[model samples]
Target: MSDRRLDDSEMATWLPTIRFVQLLPQVLDRTLKAETGLKHSHYAILVTLAGQGDRAIPMTELAQIAGLSRSRLSHAIDSLEERGWVTRTSCSSDRRTLTAALTEAGRELLRTAAPVHVAQIRALILDPLTDAEREQLGAILAKLTPGVAAAL
Candidate 1:
């Protein structure tokens, strides 16, 4: 079959995949916001920094990891700084380099919010799938992530 030769059934099957790619984030964002007072972007930033532990990352690297533009990341960081959930430090090795680290308050916030986030995930996502189905979905998403990154 040629690349353009997708028939009705193939097209129909793929439509949901495309739609899911578009809608999942917004749905998740709503749930996150309602439950934890955290936007999806803020949650992502906090989780990323928390995952990094005591080792701080440069702002640019943090932006890339969180899949945000530099400016957006800067704004989010500024907000977090204001909330005292993060601290920005000048790198000793390179005075020009700045790093963002999760503060004790940030860790506490994440710990407090973790259950709400988990419940949101369960209600909006995992509970909708069987164990096997969840595994398959995870595999599919993992496969797609690299292609999406490549395009970006």
Candidate 2:
């Protein structure tokens, strides 16, 4: 095992990344909750559905896309449905399968929520970085995110 400790530069880089990883979700949750009466998780699910072609996806596929378990996704969907933000339908080709779709209300919610979400993201994440740092951060995150997702 290497006895080498993190250098000052390494510490500087790692500290913010660690703190951001910890703080970002809370910040996002706070913003989304305050602005839209929704949690960040709920907003993410709604955005995923809204962005999809036809605004529908199979339950299992949606869960995978959202990085959620089937039960968790189902519960979120249930909450959305209760809010009239989404609806579930039997798949026409396979009655055994189900699809979740954003309703008109859901799309409208997304429209209202997106600007707030983007603003929060800019304030908390993007605006802090210098242009070069932002570019570097984008490249680094793009490179690393897939590996992180794969692990999840």
Q: What are the lDDT figures for the candidates, one per model?
A: 0.87, 0.90
lDDT of 2 by residue, 47-116 (tens): 8988885756999999888989899999999999999999999999999899999899988998899999
Which structure among the candidates has the greatest lDDT?
A: 2
Off by over 4 Å in 1: 1-7
Which regions of candidate 2 are displaced past 4 Å?
A: 1-12
Give, for candidate 1, the lowest lDDT window spanning 10 residues.
31-40
| Candidate 2: C-alpha lDDT | 0.90
Q: TM-score of predicted model 2?
A: 0.86
**Predicted candidate 1, C-alpha RMSD:** 2.4
95: Cα error in model 2, Å = 2.1
TM-score of each: 0.87, 0.86
